[model samples]
Target: MPMLGFLERLKFAQNFCKSTSLVSLILVIQSQLTLTIVPLHFSSSHILIKLSISALLLIIISGFSKCLKRLFGVSASAPALVLFNVLFVWGMHLFVIQKAIPSAANVGFNMECVLLMIGFFSILASDPGWVTDDCYGLEGAVGGTVSDAGRPCEALEVTAELSLSGGSFATRRIRYCKSCKRDIIGFDHHCPAFGNCIGKNNHPLFMVLLVGFLAVEIAYIVSSTQFTKESAIMGSALLETTLSGNLVVSTMLFSALQVLWQIVFLMWHVYCICFNIKTEEWINWKKYPEFQLPIQSQLGESYSEMAFINPYDKGISRNIMEFLSSTG
Candidate 1:
């Protein structure tokens, strides 16, 4: 029995190491970059120790993701996405900022990281307005007047009205997330990549995460511009060379992709915030042209009517503030 127990433990450890392999590689490279470039003050042995600790931390962080998911009893759709964000941010710091620029953990950069980390974890772990009978005053009754509370229940309250095809109205207050197999109150779609529903509660935090990450990337790009070019004549040539190189090339490519996509994402979110509409609603409008508000007719006459009205849109400034607070 003791031998069997040891075998089981060995099996578990093997599985864990396999799971954390990619994360550990990224961490080790990131740590090495930090010591070699960021501070440039650590000895080789100390850098080696730092790399070892980073590997340990990767395992610990993987365990932490599991703990957070189970503790909240949520089956995250995108655990890997959260982990990737960690790697991406660290890559920017270690590969791009540390390598290209000379700033070594300055106060402004550290504070930006502080905000980024706070927002990242909050989105990964925070509740996104799950439907609950207990909170809605449905007594000791399990799944009374709605679906089951802690299971693959879909029945949620109907508070708002959505116009369906053929003039039908959807009055459900919450959204049924087929992905989460759970009822969500004011439920946004299940963003498996985000590992949470972009629901009423933590939607703002997720938006903040997007904005903060974008800001961080923008700041890094601005700071690293001087390092990216040696002279004006070799502008495109230098970039191409960086792409061919292993370390800086990969980092540069990653930075370019991130900067482009993050800018678009941040801008779209800003539009949503200004309109005081949920991302789900906006997505539906894009996919279904019928859902969009009818534009003014060419002759200033009435065209088709809008499918529904947004009650939350007070004004652009107010909507922005509301989203900032996530009260909506």
Candidate 2:
């Protein structure tokens, strides 16, 4: 029995290492590809704006699709495609647009590295201890004994019902999640791009990345002088010229569209943060009532309004440590 226990422990350790290593490799590949494709000298603002639009669309589409998949028995691949597009665009920005040297591209790369490091450390610091089933088959709670499906049960009495009404479930147990041990707190669906759970500890980093990336993209767009270049070149021509009018109209339209899109995207993030809600949780309103109306209305309240405003405060850290220690 002792030898069997040792083997099982060793197997679990091996599996854990394999999972972590695979995730690290994928992130490294993604970062390298991003740095390779995205242009280093393009207007930071333009790049930032484009990327932000793409990310926001991906998040919304993916979040809704995931919810739909759970509600209906549908495939989750459609939403996954949206997520892929967002990551692909980001990779292009890093690799093609950003310069290899100490330029905007390098800055973006460094920021990504820092965010990824934080995510890595957060995962490591989290505890993976949890309960597990003994048998490899289904065990239904019929009568006092929990027997495998093969055994004939007297009646199907719901002794301890565990339903996946909102979340994903495989058979009788909650489906395995790579990063989190159980149902994530303030749970957002898994981010395949990040290859991690966007839960309590890492949600801050996700928000930081979203805001920082938008800022960087906006800076790039403004600095690139896309509009200025067009204006300056077009000014040399006659005012009444058809080409001049076309240039002005086109530039104006583009600028308006860009500004509107950025505002909408930024506002969405602000709303999520203020409401203390995850994108997934917000979208799946029926699933999470804690964030819904009446009980926790005034969803637009800012972080300052919350009792624990400063996440990085020493007191907050101490409390977290104490909680973890006790739980451990």
Candidate 3:
């Protein structure tokens, strides 16, 4: 029995490593393909032709992404798009922009890319505080039984345990994620980009990744100004510009679009962190009693306001510290 258990664990580890490696390989290939294929095929094409090709490309990519998601998960789509964009920008900057004027921005851009990749891999590899079978066991064996589908029974349970000192206890609400088809501790949401659930363990890493992306996008847009200015000096409209000019403009457009949404995303996360709340909690505030309060209306009748009353908030300073200092 012990040997069988060991073999099962070994098989699981092998499968995990294979999946991670496969995704990483796909990201690298897709990024390199974007850098190579676009320039070879569409760089000198007419503006209308390029636009038509781009639209067709998007449709093809959408279909490919659906296939990948079926094979992998929803997380596959975002990472693939992100890595491709990063590589395309880097390639253009190196081959076209830097040829005219080299600056310290190259070093900064390279560092940000490295950091972004590291953060991306870290989040993908880390556990997101999953509510495992052991957690189910801790909750009076509530979901310990396997169902007819050959999976553990899906259930939610709040569990508390006494500390070794027996002076204090910690409470945790386990939520069953329908998408993941498992329970997660302090479940935030399943981030399709990260290809993981944003639970208690890896939420901080997700934030760090978000910040890294914001910085990289901003830098890419700012540094591309030199190239854009040179293109403008040629007195040609955007549609009639040279290949390098068009590539630079395209990258800037993408970066700008990304920055707009990313800023809003970052601000929303900051608010959640300050209040020690998850996105799931914020969106479904009415479902959780912890965020509810009784308020009287002008008519003197009382009703649940569903106002934000987060019991986990330990003040902004400590909340920030807790979020930043977490290793995951």
Best by lDDT: 3
In terms of TM-score, which candidate is stronger, 1 or 2?
A: 1
lDDT of each: 0.52, 0.40, 0.63
TM-score of each: 0.56, 0.34, 0.68
The RMSD of every model to the true structure, in order and in angstroms, is 13.1, 13.7, 6.9
Question: Residue 289 CA error for candidate 3 (Å)?
Answer: 2.6
Residue 138 C-alpha lDDT in model 2: 29
Provide backbone clash counts, one per model. Answer: 5, 29, 1
**Candidate 3 TM-score over all chains jointly:** 0.68
Per-residue lDDT tens digits for candidate 1, residues 178-265, read 6766566556567755556777777777777877776776665555444545322113443333321223323333344556667887
How does candidate 2 score on lDDT?
0.40
Candidate ranking (lDDT, best to worst): 3, 1, 2
Candidate closest to the true structure, highest TM-score: 3
